[model samples]
Target: MNRITITILVLSAAATACGTSRSATGGAREGSGTVTGIITLADEVSPKTGDFCSGLNVRVTPTGAPEDVLGNGTVRTSRSRCSYQIANLPSGGESLAFSVKLPAAWQCGNGATPTVTPEPQTLQLRDYQTETRDFRVSCTAPSAETSTATP
Candidate 1:
């Protein structure tokens, strides 16, 4: 065989070997997941002004790894229901925490402070899995009243 042909064959074999080695040593793979859900307000407390959903900020991060944010999304308000989705998250046997930031202007139906159910939730995600987690914001009226009269 000619020297040029021999050299080409040797380089090709080395390239193939390197590729196989990288894969065997935990190289990048397709194992991303997604998290999506809706944010809803109580029927009685639906905001009457601007879009309340727009004020919400959804975030997902590796559990115990707050500095490493995996994904983030904002709520898209449609009438009464608001939806959000965070996609393309690495999901190889990892736990993720989901949380939201409430708008400061939110107020309850009965003139009370509003609260979010399941303020922060964590779940285990697998490859190519799409997890659904819903959140609700609601509040109840204060049962006790304070008297301002003084003698």
Candidate 2:
């Protein structure tokens, strides 16, 4: 085989290996699942009642226990607007904690991400294949209450 052809083959092989590299963190795979629904307060007060909490954030953490923040991140919706709909999440056992957060208001010029850490909620999966986790935010403020509650 010509030297040019041999070099091309080696480069191609290297590129393929790099594309599918996996390290400590399980890189990537093909599995389908979903998490959708609106983020509403657990209290009887309707979200449409016009309140600061109406625009609250909904975040998901992959942890059965609320204390365990396996994977912490906020969901994306409209600009600066938060919603509860983490679509097509990775497939795994029920290991997520849902919470209603009041993230920092960027418009106010405060760079800090202000968050209202509600009681951690254990999510239940209908089916690992395709699940819908519709949860409610704990209306009872954590500060006012002493004992912690789980959802």
Candidate 3:
């Protein structure tokens, strides 16, 4: 074979090998599963009567994988905007955590992400499938009581 043709074949083989190596090293494959969740608040008042998921963020990140994943939350919606989704999550023995962020003007009663029933509200996803987890944050405000004395 010509020298040029031989070099091209070698290069192509090398490229294919590298691609396979990446996939073996946990690179995401086609049809990866998604991690979807919704953030609801536990309060005396209902979200419909008070606040919705609008302007709120539901953040999801793989546990101990890295810092956090991007594009994992929902945006403000005209109606109820509480659902959040993290697409293309590499499924394995991996688990994910969900947290909520309120707008600057608002704050949770505890001033922190409420401890959802599941604690971190994690999801164990499987390949080519979607996993769902629900998180709850309390928006209830501290109540005040008054006392009166008469003489």
Candidate 4:
């Protein structure tokens, strides 16, 4: 092959190694960025799941993405801690929708309940970066339980 042709082939192969490149085998470095956040309630309630936050689930979807992209970023409460993280997200400026799920055991009590209305939040994320946002729910202890608290 001519020198020009060989040089072009080499450049093409090199460019394909970048993060944004997609290989013929459907291999690409996707989701090099991360998105993280916490879930909290106005009132403290007993964690139904061991040390972890109970009656909670988190779902994150790419903003303006197609419906077929379901289940891209999804997590359920199980371990200790109320925070969650979605890693390996594609780089560049992207948006996400954060939402939660609560079980029946999470009492509404006398205080406000977790904010699930006003629409779930949409967060913008970039590659090789982490976005931290918290979601507050209006949850309160039972009236009797709260009243009986030690002084």
Candidate 5:
């Protein structure tokens, strides 16, 4: 092998090594997609204290594989809204499920347990696609009657 040919070969190998990194789960980083959305409280419900926006948790996993979490992010207060984004997901028209959980203190406006809309949403994600799925949480002020009731 001549010196020029050997140099070219080495450069090619180096480039390949640096191309298309891998994610934490050993998945190819290329062709990854992102999921982003906002979490909102129902219009008629509100909490007196604590930052509800910052207490929301979002999780992404491959559909039917709850144990394998692709990515997760906490919602942040963005301009009077709760927003979150889970990026770097392995996308190839694969089915992925997303779910959100609100803080325990929040209760449904109907005086029941709190619940979010579109729970455990599953959808096909394509490479380089950015999907948006918003969620609305129903919550109201803590029931004073229950809290004050004596045993």
Candidate 6:
């Protein structure tokens, strides 16, 4: 019981079994993985807006975060509708790219028939798999222009 306290108790049980033998997957490792999605609004009328976007802003650039923000970077929705979501992320195994900005003059039609004709536009998403990927966005505005008005 004295060899330097049994070699410091066998190096503290081998450093707690190498920190619990690693294995969480979602934390991505064995080939790495992660990516979740949801950003809607591919109809009505929308195309020329800013303020970081009104109803959707799912940004991600993984592969070891090629410039900060690799998970839950941006995600917002309202401006009447058009879903939005971006969680966890960090799996850029397929060179990702997703962009949807609409809220300036904001018009995706069908808000009650604002010249209804599938007006809104501006929806792009690549690689896919932000959990499942279900994006849509269209641009257009007017009719008292509202959608949070702006910043």
Question: TM-score: which candidate is best?
Answer: 1
Candidate 1 lDDT over residue span 36-151, tens digit each: 88877887665745677777778877678776667434468776767888876667877777778877767776887777786777877787899988888888777788899999
Candidate 4, 1-151: lDDT as tens digits: 6999999998988888675655322334355666677666544544445544544566555666433232235344633347666666556556656566765566554554545433567765565677776666665343453466687
Best by lDDT: 1
Q: Can you give the TM-score per candidate against the true fold?
A: 0.67, 0.40, 0.50, 0.52, 0.66, 0.25
Candidate 3 local accuracy as lDDT?
0.57
Give per-residue CA lDDT, model 5, range 73-105, as digits (tens).
446776556888888876888777777767776
Clashes in model 4: which pairs? 31-88, 31-89, 31-90, 91-127, 112-138, 113-138, 114-137, 114-138
Tens-digit per-residue lDDT, 15-89, candidate 3: 999877533224552236676766565663244444555656666566675355533334443334356676666
Local error of candidate 4 at 89, Å?
1.7
- In model 3, pairs of residues that clash are none
* Candidate 6, 1-151: lDDT as tens digits: 6998989999999999887764332344222333444444454545534433453445545334434434444454446344445554434354444444444465545554224223323222334433445555543443575487566
lDDT of 5 at 114: 67
What lDDT score is found at residue 29 in candidate 5? 30
State in Å the error of residue 8, model 3. 13
Candidate 3's clash total is 0
Q: By summed lDDT, which 10 consecutive residues of candidate 1 come out lowest?
A: 22-31
After superposition, which runs of candidate 3 have C-alpha atoms over 4 Å from their true positions?
1-31, 40-55, 70-73, 76-78, 107-119, 143-151
Total clashes in model 2, counting residue pairs 3 or more apart in sequence or in different chains: 2
Flag regions of model 2 displaced more than 4 Å. Answer: 1-31, 40-57, 64-82, 87-90, 106-120, 124-128, 133-151
> Model 6: residues >4 Å from true position, as ranges?
1-33, 37-40, 51-71, 75-107, 113-130, 137-151
lDDT of 6 at 9: 93
Worst 10 residues of 5 by lDDT: 22-31
The lDDT values for all models are 0.73, 0.46, 0.57, 0.57, 0.71, 0.46
Regions of model 1 farther than 4 Å from truth:
1-31, 48-50, 72-74, 143-151
